[model samples]
Target: MSQMNQPDLIGIADVAAKIPAFLNKIPNLLHGLKQAYLRTPNTPTGLGMAFEKAVLRNPDGNALLFEEQRYSYAHLNAWANQIAHFYLSLGAQKGDVVAVMIENRPELIATVIGLAKIGVTIALLNTSQVGKVLAHSINLVKPFAVIAGEECRVALDEIRHELAIAAGHFHWFADQDTQTDAGQAPEGFVNLAEKIDLFPKFNPSTTGSVQGKDGLFYIYTSGTTGLPKAVIFSNGRWTLAYGTYGHVLNLNQEDVMYCTLPLYHATGMVVCWCGVIAGSSALAIRRKFSTSSFWKDVKKFDASAIGYVGELCRYLMDAPPSEQEHGHRVTKMIGNGMRPNIWDKFKARFGIKEVLELYASSEGNVGFSNVFNFDNTVGFSPTPYAIIEFDKERNEPVRDTKGHCKRVKKGETGLLIGKITRRSPFDGYTDPEKNKSVIMTDVFTKGDAYFNTGDLVRDIGFRHAQFVDRLGDTFRWKGENVSTTEVENMLTEYDKIVEAVVYGVEIPNTNGRAGMAAITLQPGSELNEQDLKQMVSTFKQCLPAYAIPVFLRIQQQVETTGTFKYQKNQLKEQAFDPQKTDERLLVLLPNATEYCELTQEIFNNIQAYQYRF
Candidate 1:
C-alpha cells in the first residue's frame, strides 16, 4: 500500500506508471522538509505514564477484546489495580520480578499493567518455549513468583519441576472460560477476572511509583545459539514504542487492532498493545496462528488494523486471493521484516494503504517507525542508524588503520549498529558481562560505544534503511531466532554425528529463513532415519521449538577452513534436496518425526506446494 519501486510495480499498470516521476521528485520533497514536523523524538519515559494518560483521557473507551468479551478503560484499570494490591499484600515491592506466562489473553495485559503500577517487574515467558528450555528461561529470570494460565499450568508444572523452581512460586489464572467471572477474592491462585471487582478503586499517586528508567519488563530473546538472553526492557523504551505507534502512526479511536501473534513478542507488545492503550479496541486470538482463520477473525472483529512480522504477511498472501483479503476494514498495518520482492504484492492484495514498516529491538533503545508510510524502506528514524560492512567469514568489521569503522555506501549491505549514548542508552541485560558482549567500545574513537544490532542492513540512502539479512550465524525462523551453534551443538551430541554445521537456507514462501544443518558422522556409521528421528525428538524435548532444524544433510566430513571454521556458504546454497548436491540429505516431512531421503520427486512436491511447513 505504500510507495512502490518501478520493477515491483511493473505488473500493476497503475502503480508502474506513477513510479518514474514519483521516484525523481520524492528525494527533493523529503529534503525540502524542515525539522519541525519530522523531528519528533523517541517514545516517552514510561509504559505506566502512557497507560495513565490514556486511561485519564479515555476512561470509557474499549481497551481489549477476547472473542466477544471486552474490557473498557475503567475495567482494565480496576483489574490492574486489584492485581497490584494483591501483589502488595504478598510483600511485592518496587523492582520485584513477577514472571508471567500466558498466550494472547486479557489477563496477560492486566497482570503486566497491574505489576507495573506497583513497580513490580514483569518477566515475559514465551508460550512456545516448553520443556527444558522453558524451565531454563524461567530460572534465568529468577522471579519471586510466576503468574501463568491454567492451560499453561501443566507446562509450567513440568518446567517448575525440571528447573527445581519451587511449586509455590506459581500463580495460575484460568483463561478459557469467559462467561465465568472470578471476581476479586482469594482463590487457589488469584483469578484474574475476580481480581478486577475486588481490586481497590483507582487512586492516582506519584509517590513510591515506578519511573522512566525503571525496568518495565524482562524478555528472553533468541541468542545466536544456546539459552535465550533475558533482555532488560525499561519503562522509557515502552513509552517510546507507545508514542511511536499510537501518536506517530495516528491510530484512531475507531481502530480495532487484531493481535493474533503471541503477546510475549516485541511486535505484539509494542505494535499491538500500544494501539489499544491509545484508546483503540484490541482483538486477541487465544489459539495458534492459522492463516485460514485469519481473515475470518478480522472480518468478525471489524478490525481496522493488524500487527505482523514478514512470515505472517506471507501466510496471508499465500491463501489464494480472496475477496475477503481486501473486503475487510483493515486499511493500515505496522510491523517489521516485509521482504522487498513480495512487499508490493502483499500490500495490494491485502488492501493495506499504509505499511508502517519499522526496525527495532526488544532490548534496544533506538528504533525507527515509518511515519511517512514509505515503501521498501523500513521508513526512517531521527535516531542515528549506521550500516557498516562486515566480513561473515571473519565475523568482524573491516576497519581502517585510523581505527574508524566505515559505513556502507548507498545500496550496499553491512552490519547495522546504533550509537550508544546517555540519552540513547542500551540498558542491556541484568548480567553486565552479557551486556558487555553486545556493546562495542572504541568504534569510531576512544570512549565511543555502539550497540551491535547483530543484523545486516542495506543503506537505501535518503535517510532510509532496508533490512537486508542477519549477520553472524543466527538467523530468524518463523519470527524466532535460531542459533546455528546451538543447533549444531545439539546435533553433534549424537553418537553417529561427529560434527555439524548449521545455517539458514532460503525456503520458498517463508518468513526470515528456514533452518538446515549439514552434518558429518563418525566413520562407517550408516545414516539411519530412525536414529535421526530419535535425535530430533531429543532436540524437541531439550531445545525451544523454534530452534529445531527443518532440514538435515549427512556428509562424510564437513568442509572447514584452516582455522577450523565450518564452511556454511556452500552448504546453505545446497539446501536439502538430493539433486542439489551429492551429499545424502534428509528432511522432516510435514507431520512426521523421522527424516527421509530427499528425493527429486519429494523435493519438487515441497517446492510446488505438495508439502506444508
Candidate 2:
C-alpha cells in the first residue's frame, strides 16, 4: 500500500469524551441567541438595522468597550449619527464611497455603521499600508472623502503630494488624544471629532430610504495579484452570512468577543462587528496583536469568545504553556486558517470546546460554517460550492474533453469554486477588468458561471472540507494575500539578485504565513546587509509592511523542474535559517531594517516566545 493510504486516522476520542461538557455549555449561549431574537424582529434589512433599532430601544445598554472607553448603545448611535450628519454636511450624497483609515477603535465601528446607515459606501483601508500602495488604495476606491486618524497623518501626508484629491476631500479624525475632546484637524482637512462634539445626534438619514441590496461597504482584495480590487459588500450579503454563522455557531448576546485583528479586515468586520450587532459587546485592541499579553487581555475583558486567523493561533501556540493557560472564560472561537498540524494542540491548550472554522472570501457569495463543530473541517455551506481539479501550472480549472469539470472525490484535494449567478453573485471589485479575471463563464454548462476562489481545498465528504494551500502565486499573511510573483519581481530588480523564488513559511507563532525568499545571486556578485536593507526598504515603500519578506536565503542557483517553474516546496521547507539548510540565510529581526545571521540563540528565543511582535 502507498504511504498515504497506510492509515485511517483515529476519531476525535477526547472530543467525544468531552461531549457532556460541550453540551452543558450550549444551553446558556442558545438562550442568549433566543433572547436577542425575541428582543428584535428579523427584517429584510441586515443585522446593523436590527442592531440600530435595538440600540434605540435600549439606549443605556453597553454597546462597545474598547481601550479604556465604554460606549453605550446611545453613545454609539449618537456617534454614528454625528458622523452620518458630518458626511451629509460635506456633500457626501448617497452611494458616495467614504474611505476610512483607522485602527481597531470604537470610531472604526461607528464609521462602518454610520456609513451603512447613511447609504454611503465605506472603503475600509488597511492600517499597515503606507507610501505609494496606500495612495493607490485610496485612488482605487475613488471616495468622495477620506476619513483618517491623526496617527495616520504622516502616512497620508507622505502620499498627499501625489494624490489627485482636493483639500476639501480629506477629513481627519483626531484620536491620538482621545481623552480630551477629539482634537481639531490640521489645515486643509475637516475635523470630524470636533464637529461631532458640538452637533446634536441625528437619526440615520437613510432610514427606510435604503434596502438590503444597497451597497454598504467596499473592501479591496490584498493586491497580491495586481492592483487591489474593490469587493462591494451589500447590506443583505453580510446580514445573511453573519446571521447564518451566528445561528450555526451559536454566537450569543452576553458573550464578550475579544478581537485583536484589524477591524478593516473582513474577519474582524464579520466576527467582531456581527457579534456587536447580535447584542454582544466586542472588545477591540487598537494596535497589533501581542501574543504575550493575549491571555491577560482576554481575562481582563472577561471575553467568552475570540476571533482569529491562522497567525494568531500559531502565536498563541508558541507562547510558553502556563498553569493559567486554560484559566480564562473563553468557550468558543470563530475564524479561519487554523492548520491541521496545530488544530488539536491549539484547541487543547486554549481549552476551546467549539471552533467554528470558516472558509469564505471577500468576494465569494458562498461560505462554509462548521455547524457540527467538526475538529478540522471548515464545515459545510448551504449554497452552491464545488471542489474541482485544478491545473496549478496554468493556474486554471481543469476540464475533461467531454466539457465537464472534474469534481474532487471524497477525501481528495481540488480547487474550491463557488457558482455565481443572480442568487449567488460574485459581487466583485470596483474594477470591471479585475472582476472579470476570476469569473468563469459557461464553466460547467452553457449557462453556468462560477467564481474561482484561488484556494486549494480537500473534500472530506459529508459537507465538510479541509483547507489546503492557496492556488497560484499568492500567499497569506495577517489574513492578507502576499503575491510571490510581486515579491519576486521586486527582488529581481536588485543589482545582486539574479532570480527569486518567494513562498510562505510556517513561522512558530504568526498569522497566515510569513514571507521568505530564496534568491540566486548574479554571477560574481556578493550579498551584503546594506544592499539587502536598501532593496527591502525600497520594496516596503511600494508595498504594505506585511508583504515584506522576513527571511532571505542567498543561493548560487535556484532549482527548477524541466519546465523551468521555480520549485517553492523545497525552499518553503528549508526556510531562512542557515542551520536548517545548506544555503546561507539571513533573518530580519522585528523593527530592524537590516538582516542578521540566524544564530541558534536567536532561533531558540523566537521559538521560546522571548521576542515580542
Which one is best on TM-score?
A: 1
Predicted structure 1: clash tally: 5
Candidate 2 lDDT over 1-613, as tens digits, reads 4324423221356346646655753664465444323222123465447567668666776677766787777878888887777777777776788888888777787777777777788888877777656787888777787888887777888888877777777878777644366776788788777776665586764655655676777876755554555788876676666555655545544667788887777888875567556554544454678887888888877788888888788778877887556689897788888887899888887888888889888888778877667777887676788899988767677988967788876777898889975556677777787777887777678878888888898777656678888766677886788778767776666677888888888666565678888889878888775786787677677667777788888878877656345467657666755576876777778888877777778877877757654
RMSD of 1: 5.4
Instruction: Give the TM-score comparing model 1 with the true structure, all chains together.
Output: 0.87
Model 1 lDDT at residue 465:
73
lDDT for model 1, please. 0.72
Worst 10 residues of 1 by lDDT: 32-41
Segments of candidate 1 deviating more than 4 angstroms = 1-45, 162-167, 178-198, 201-208, 279-286, 492-498, 520-529, 532-536, 557-562
lDDT values, one for every candidate? 0.72, 0.73
> With candidate 1 superimposed using the best TM-score fit, by how many Å does residue 435's alpha carbon deviate from the native?
1.9
lDDT of 2 at 300: 77
